[model samples]
Target: MRILLTNDDGIQAHGLRVLYKAFREAGHDVHCVAPVTEQSAVGHAVTIALPLRVKEFKENGFRGHGVYGTPVDCVKLALSALLYEKPDLVVSGINAGANVGVDLLYSGTVSAATEGAFMGFPALAISYDDFNHEGLTGEHGSYVANLVERLPLDNLPHKCVLNLNFPNRPVAECRELRICRHTSAMWEDWYDQRHDPRGRPYYWLTGVIPPEKVSADTDRALLTAGHVTLTPLRFDFTDYDLIQSLGGSLE
Candidate 1:
């Protein structure tokens, strides 16, 4: 299969490199186009005014393009300009950290794959829950790559993408994958006020992420229980039910 790889973390990230190697070793033709710098929290924004720059880089037997833009821009350019033919699938990440719940609204990794999904292709966004590289290795990368290969892309909903989050456990301990729903969770905090060297006020946003109340089949609950969570995400944010109810009230 021909796969287009991308990520929110820049092209040089270890996570991207490891996954690229695993995909190539699996005999699939893989092409990568990622941001030149980390584009985390950028969501699904595409460049509108300024021109995007794409530069080529060769490393670890994988040739890739680094775009001086957001993760969404990288995927857009790859499909429209870079690749001569349409890829069978678009896979974003092996990202450095998990993208779950309300956090998906700010995740460039998920946004990159969503861009592909909007263009009529099966797209996936895979992330490792932990930010630390304690036990991360080629074997772990291979395991995730295999899981991506086994996904039922042929039966997925139109213009929808799979948002996958793996546990921080060792690859050998990765037991089962669960089809789950995104948790209705959110971060709660305010900025900390501090003084600069010149006695000016500055604020640093820092706080703990409080856990949400778990409902049945939530991605957060499944991930906390050590299962790999696969949530089918759609680009449409419309509340159709609300619209219908409002129409009756307005009339």
Candidate 2:
């Protein structure tokens, strides 16, 4: 398959390099177009007003393009102008952190894959379940490469994007991949007030997931259990039932 790889973590992230190597070794043609800087939580944003810049992104012997904008912008440019030939699949990450539960609402990694799907391509948003990488390497990259190789891509729903999360455990220890649901959970949010050297106050947003609310079938729950989770996602955000419920009630 000809694959177009991208990430919110920028074109130079280790995860992208690992995925690039694994895919090449698996005999697939791959190209990358990603943010020049990390755009992690900037979900689905597009650069419309400001003129976007594009430059060559190269590191550790790999070559790709870097866009001075959001992850969605990179994929949009790739499908619309960057790649010489359209990719058969768009793989948006091996992101630094998992995009599960309500976190999906603010994930640029997921949004990149979503943009690909919206452009009518089969896509995947992949990530590691652990945020602390203390011991990750390219050695385990094949686990993801093989998953893509074995997936029934032709069987997926039209314009569907899959969100895949690998557990923090060793790749060899990774258990069966399971189809799962995003957790119906919310972050316990708080802002940390801090002072600068000049005595100015600044607040940094911080939050945590309430573990007790995590259910058995959610991607977060499965990832916590050492299973790789695959959640099929769609770009459509319509709440049809609610739309019907309020259709005739409003004046």
For this target, which candidate reaches the highest lDDT against the unseen true structure?
A: 2
Show where candidate 1 strays beyond 4 Å.
Answer: none
> What TM-score does structure 2 among the candidates reach?
0.95
Q: For model 1, name the residue pairs that clash.
A: none
* TM-score leader: 2
Clashes of each: 0, 0
lDDT of 2 by residue, 68-180 (tens): 99999999999999898989899988888889976667999999998998898889999887666544567557887888888888788888989998888788788889998
Q: What is the C-alpha RMSD of each candidate to the true structure, in Å?
A: 1.7, 1.5
After TM-score superposition, what is the CA distance of residue 23 in candidate 1 from its true location, in Å? 0.4
* Runs with alpha carbons beyond 4 Å of true place in candidate 2: none
Candidate 1 lDDT over residue span 1-251, tens digit each? 89999999899888888888898889889999999998888888889999999899986576999999999999999999999989989999878778888777789999999899998899999888887645567886787678767888788899989988888887778758888889886767799999999999999986545665666588877887888888998867799999999999999
